[model samples]
Target: MRVLITGVAGFIGMHLALQLLQRGDEVVGIDNFNDYYDVRLKESRLQRVVDADTAGKFTFIRLDLADRAGMAKLFAEEGLDAVVNLAAQAGVRYSIENPLAYIDSNLVGFGHILEGCRHNGVKHLVYASSSSVYGANESMPFSVHDNVDHPLSLYAASKKANELMAHTYSHLYNLPTTGLRFFTVYGPWSRPDMAMFKFTQAILAGQPIDVFNYGKHRRDFTYIDDIVEGVIRTLDHTARPNPEWSGMKPDPGTSKAPWRVYNIGNQNPVELMDYIRAIEEALGKKAELNLLPLQPGDVPDTYADVDALVQDVDYRPSMSVDEGTRRFVQWYREYYKV
Candidate 1:
């Protein structure tokens, strides 16, 4: 299948592109290469994708999702079989500082994607959602069926809006759309702003690492490979209407239309302190902790219920935090020569 992956220079996008290329799928990837964190890291990821495309199956384009004309032109020209919409301004805390970024990228940009998929005869539209949507809902294991009307941040609200936008397209156009609510995704080639990467960097530099919420936050840190696998599986399995869905008791995860949402997570929540210990173990260096209060727009804990994912995809994330951290630390050392 020929796939169009937005944010192709992103951590998950790059990894997903390589996997698709390796499996003999033609890929057209696009990214704006914004200076959110480090453009060099994004460029390196794209370069890796290019190097892996020995069969000439991958193409990279410099494009932003917010550019309506550019996105329309690419969609009309590419003749894509499927689209994985992964491009968005992706930091939860950053949204507090720059709310407009989320509106432009996540809301307006995603509208363009929906229009493209609706018109282009794309069989499946698989997009990324987030665990942060479960804000203020003290549910133990966050389930897609639960109501997510109380989002704490603009970023979370934008993601929830994406799911709503996709469902509208699905119902109106019979488009098969699936939204994967990703947990705290971490592994090699991760974003520098993420906790794992920052902690590692600070620990190696002998600097104090800020422990948010006084090290009380728990997260379901799903590995990148696991997330990629789940995404690929979901992309292949085009969403279908649930026959049993009733309007009387509407299920948030599924609808009468060809739209569905699933939580793609490890289903294992780890405390912040334990996760830090894993990093310390990986690098053989102790981190000086500066305990801090939880910042605004932050959740105390997040745990995903991935039973729907397992049932539909026949896959479960098996990577433990310890092993995943070790692999990331190894990659970090090699990537930076530290």
Candidate 2:
């Protein structure tokens, strides 16, 4: 299949693109290489992908999702068989500082994607949503069927909006759309803004690491490889209308139209302190602690109920937090020569 993957230089996007290319699929990747994080990291990831593609099954294009005209032209020419959109303004606390970034990248950019897929006869459209959409619910294990109308941040709201927008296209154009609500995704080549990256960096630098929520927060920190696996499975399994869906008691996860949502996460939730400990153990360096309160637009916990994903894809994430963290630290040390 010829697949178009947005945000190809991103952590998850790069992994997904490489996996697709390895499995004998033609992959076209696009990224603006924005300064939201370190552009050098993005470049390094893209370089790895290019080097790994010995079969020459991959193509990389520098493009922004917000450029409507450029997106339209690309879609017209690419003849895409499927699309995996992982691009967005990704940080929750960053949303509190710059809300417009979320609007431009998450909302307007998603609009262009929906339009592109609608016109190009794309068979499957799998995109990234967030576990943060379950904001203020206080649910032990956040489920796709749960109500997510009360998002705390603009980032979460924009993800929810993307789900709604995709449903519209699915209903009107018979486009098969699937939204994967990702939990705390972490691994090698992760964004510098993420907690795992920051914690690892501070520990290696002999600086104090800020432990948020006083190290009480628990997260279903999904591994990057597991996320890419779920994404590929969902992309293959084109969404279909839920025959048992009812209008009287509507399920937020599935629709009568070809639209569905699943939680892509490691079902195991790990405490923040334990996660930090893993980093310390991996690097053999104890971190100086600065215990801090949870920042705005942040949740105390996130545990994804991936039952829907298992039921549909017959797959579940199985990476332990310890193993995942060690791998991330290994990559960090090698990449930075720490």
Candidate 3:
């Protein structure tokens, strides 16, 4: 199968591209490599994909999702069999400073992708939605079937909008679209902005790490491999119309249209302090603690109910938070030479 993966240089996208290539699928990866974090890290990830022995199965293009003309051209030329739209302006706090970036990328850029897929005979459209969409909900385990109308941050709002937009496309064009509400994805080649990376960097520098919400937050930090696995499975199995779906009592996770949403989480929420302890254990050093209140657009906790994922794809993200953190710390040390 020929697959087009947007944001191919991104943490998850890079891993997905390699997975596809290794399976003998031709992968075309597009990324602007914006300065959301360090472009160097994204470049290096792209290199790893390109440098692989199966690299001949992969192609890289430097392009932004906001470029409508270029995006259209890509779809027209490539005639993609399927697409994974992972490109977005991805940070909760940063969205406060640069809300326009989210609008342009998450909104407008995604609009272009939907248009392209709808017109290009693409079989499947799998997109990245964040667990942040479960904002303000006090539910113990976040479920896709639960209500998600209240988004505390612009970032979360944009993701919710993406899900809505995708449903519209699916309904209008019979497009098979799947939106994955990813948990806190972390592992090797992770975004520098995420907690795992920041904590590791601070611990290695012997600097104090800021414990958000006074170290009271809990997150279902899903490993990159698990995320990639869920994505691949969903990509292969195109969304189907829900036979039980009714407009009278609609399910947020499925519809009459070929659209579906699922929580791709580890189903294990770990406390912020415990996560930091893992970092400390892996690095053999304790972090100078700087406890702070929760920042805007932040949530108290996130726990994903991946029961649907398990029942559908036999998806079980079994990596313990301790093991995942240790691996991340090890990678951070090796990558940064700390």
Q: Rate the local accuracy (lDDT) of all candidates.
A: 0.95, 0.94, 0.92
Per-residue lDDT over 174-219 for candidate 3, one digit per residue giving the tens place of the 0 to 100 score: 9999999999999999998999898888878889998889999999
Which wins on lDDT, candidate 2 or candidate 3? 2
Q: State the weakest 10-residue window (summed lDDT) of model 2.
A: 203-212
TM-score of 3: 0.99
TM-score of each: 0.99, 0.99, 0.99
Tens digit per residue, CA lDDT, model 1, 203-269: 9999999999999999999999999999999999999999999999999999999999999999999
lDDT of 1 at 281: 95
Order candidates by lDDT, high to low. 1, 2, 3
Tell me the lDDT of model 3 at 15.
93
Per residue, candidate 2 scores C-alpha lDDT tens digits across 199-227 of 98888788999888899999999999999
Q: Global lDDT for candidate 2?
A: 0.94
Better of 1 and 2 by lDDT: 1
- Segments in model 3 whose C-alpha atoms lie over 4 Å from true places: 53-55
Cα misplacement distance, residue 66 of candidate 3 (Å):
0.7
lDDT score, residue 160, model 2? 94
